[model samples]
Target: MKLRTLLAVFGVALALTGFTLVAAPGLASTITLDEAVLVFVGLLGVLQGVRVAIARSRTAYEQVETPDPEASQDLPTPGDEFDEMLATAGADRREREMRESVRNRLERAAVATIVRTEGCTEAEAKRRLESGEWTDDPYARAFFTGSVEGASLFDRIDLRRDNQSRYHRWAVHAASEITRRSEGFDA
Candidate 1:
């Protein structure tokens, strides 16, 4: 049974017992067990009702009000939000890959240029690039002087406005040299 119903029944029983005791005063003194049991039951019912009331009030206060359905319509659905996040991440990955590709192409061209002009091995050219050491040759110096650590390809280009054109020229030159070597041609 519900707490309210149980408490109400106990209250009614207590009132009947009190009435019975008042109607028979002589018997009430003789019935010590019945009086004590009724008093205990009454106190228990009152305490339990108070506890139930407090619990109900606390839950009511803790309950959250529902947001208006019209207001919620303005919010993006989970799927739409997920798609937006995925698109942003994909774009970021593509941009990073592009930057890395440009950086690699610049390095390869610089390495190939050094090997062709200075008569050095590719490994030695790469080491020279890393060491920031340049030869007297203008072409080699052009590649070497443009080097900057941790800078993006565009940032490097911005540092020297001509570096962008230089990078393109060097990249073409590197590709041609690779093709020539692969084809077993001295040129």
Candidate 2:
């Protein structure tokens, strides 16, 4: 309660009272002086509330953002990082080892998911993949069992045209199928 703030508030209330009296001389005839003072006090309270709100909003905007280490712990998803690995693996011969690693990782994840959902042993889950009974997707079945020979003669030739592209497409489809199956879905 600084003297300056008190005086400013009092001055504002008084000016509002005078303005009300001058602007509506007809109302002044109906409303008593005590009621006029009460109205001025209420107006002052509303003005004070609005002033506080504006000051708070300005201060909130001016505050600097502080980083939290825990909040910054977001990591790239396994699928996203896998996509990057596949891109790098396809672009260069040196990433052949990474490509194989990625393939193994994808297969392992699928096998694990199948085992978890189907209540089967790992070997049985892999057997399902070998028989193409795990999923109805031809590319996924081919990719898992490493058999690209079952398509039509022309289709097989087309699939063999670019091994990298074919493998990438199979990998993406297989990943999606695995994700769908893991979520108790069949698509």
List the lowest-lDDT window of 10 residues for candidate 2.
148-157
1-187 per-residue lDDT for model 1 (tens digits) = 4667777877897799789989999878886887788878778877787777877777745568997676434766644543343334334545555435654655786677668766899999898866656342333334445543444677556545652344444333334444444355254
lDDT of each: 0.58, 0.78
Record all residue pairs in model 2 with backbone atoms less than 3 Å apart, i.e. clashing.
none
Model 2 gets an lDDT of: 0.78
- Candidate 2 structure quality by residue, lDDT tens digits, 1-187: 4447767978986788679979998977999879867877887787777777766777745568888666567787856878888888667867779879878988898889889888899999988877888887777787778765346777666766775776677777788898888898442
What lDDT score goes with residue 4 in model 2? 72
Error of 1 at 47 (Å): 99
Error of 1 at 66 (Å): 82
Q: What is the lDDT of residue 154 in candidate 2?
A: 75
lDDT of 1 at 154: 72
